[model samples]
Target: MANIKIVLADTDDKYLMPLERKFIDGLEDKADLIVITDPDYLKEYFSEPQRVDILIINEELYDAELERHNIASVFILTEQELLNNNTGDAEANRIYKYTSVKEIYAEIIGKSSARSETLNTKEETKILMMYSPIGGIGKTTVSAALCEALAKYQKKVLLIGIDSLQTIGSVIPQLPFMESGTEKLLIEKSEYVYEAVKTKIINRTFDLLPPFHLSLPSLNIKGEDYINLINGIRDSKDYDYVIVDGATGFTEDLSRLMGVADHTIILAGQDKNAVYKLDCLLRNIDCSDNDRFVFVCNKYRNNRENFLANGYMTNFCRVSEYIELWTENSASEEGVLTNNRSIQKLALMFI
Candidate 1:
């Protein structure tokens, strides 16, 4: 019921004038709207904490200071809905530069109200880890699909790829190849891990920290560092869910990741070696006291008989779900899960 103070910072008159007119016409009595067309003045205005209810600025002008400001909600204005991996804020919501003024008003008001509600009643963020003991089984595909499906439901999602090879770039080509992301967070003490990850998001589907560009068999990230990163992301409160795509095998890094994960999706295929390695992984890793462990059989070919006869499912304590994406052509199709209702249904279990 209180008056909301909103700030619109951008230099383009062609884009700014229309939005300014609409804000005054629609919210004259309800809010105070301040429009700044200069980047320097905007930066100076946000140098200190301001009592802003909502702050909308162009993506090019965004910085950590804007985030440091005590604003109820922040939205980045961009040419496209999907932000580039380098310049966008993963934590903050975004609006298209060419959208209708009514749509802009609705977005600002809706998100500001939601922010107030969230602040008043804090909710837990769900953390899901997609892991496999062996590689080359469509693990990255399933992880990307799950994130996309979750986003389709309007849930804020963050996806972190900890694999040494950095397969997420291939899975989601829209994402930029960052030379250092999670590793930068680890090595540098000045940057915040949550803020760093927020800037590397792609398509609003998920916030991602692309894997380090390392050809080594193992990553330089320590167990404590990995745990700290996860804890930082969980505590950020920017996302509704955090999805991690972990490396294969039972390494210390994988163990630490699973240890903090709320739900662990153990991916396997119909291959005998894959099943055997998965059984070995189950025995070696300590997941007995975790929150939840789900076994997902990817590329399933109606091999229920083979799965049961080979006693593959019996090796694990429980099999939470199975996915049937067995076609040779299905793997090549982009946005397969986003367009497929059946696949989206299977992905909803993570939520």
Candidate 2:
């Protein structure tokens, strides 16, 4: 049985059907969702002595008397544009009716539980690290898009960016100005980075840890720190998927950290320099578990001749030309992922 029970009261049978399916698909067994379309049934359902963790009700059907039921939380969904409607019942929530289901579900989860409290309650979190042997090839774009995609599909996803170059702030503009999660975690050398980082998490499509505020070299975050931090999240087991977004370029330290991931996505192009750098990195790293890596050829031109480089090939995870990050001038790219769909195939690799 799911640990939480959620009741949704709405008279639209068609509207509730898809929301029920979406809840089933995204939450799986984490939340038991009940949809009541009949107003009488909705009243009777709540009248019974039942434990409902959350109640999302249509404003028309909601009665002030229902507050006596002591429901854990009650959210009123309004179809009209109402201003300052949170006037009564201070604990009640007023939500616009047309928001995406994923956004609503994300908000519910953010309010229902704390990351630290979920430790040991979830299954193992699969860690996927995104890296680029060459810069300006949509690593951040792919990672951010994939994070949202997974959250839409499963509703439990965590995104951690270690972008010392500060590109993630531009890529994920919702990110609250830097919180130094890296410095705080390393200073205490704590095993609670997952919990500590999520305290500042916004209720977006997915929860993102405020990325490393300082340069990695300044803090000297080593391979062990990476292992401990990632393993801590895995052991905590709060998320279904954990996506770690890497910064520009590649290095031995970066490669060593990539080794910690359950699956590693290395982005490159069809150029000789990309092949040379990846080849060198492969030679340096312990490729004993070779199947863990996914080499992606970004900005792919569909040229078969360019695909064959130094006897190696990369999976083409290309973004359209409209995305300004295709070249080395990623600084000009903003909101490239607003309508991007190329990341679905990449998201399927983990799902």
Q: How much is the lDDT of residue 59 in candidate 1?
A: 79
**Tens digits of lDDT, candidate 2, 297-331:** 66666544454243433332222222223432432
Ten-residue stretch with the least lDDT total in model 2: 315-324
Rate residue 4 of model 1 by lDDT: 72
TM agreement with the true structure for every prediction: 0.59, 0.57
Error of 1 at 70 (Å): 34
> Per-residue lDDT for 203-257 in model 1, tens only?
5455666555673245465555656767877787777788888787777777777
Candidate 1: minimum summed lDDT over ten consecutive residues — where? 114-123
Q: In candidate 1, residue 97 scores what lDDT?
A: 75
Q: What RMSD, rounded to one decimal, does every model reach?
A: 14.1, 8.5
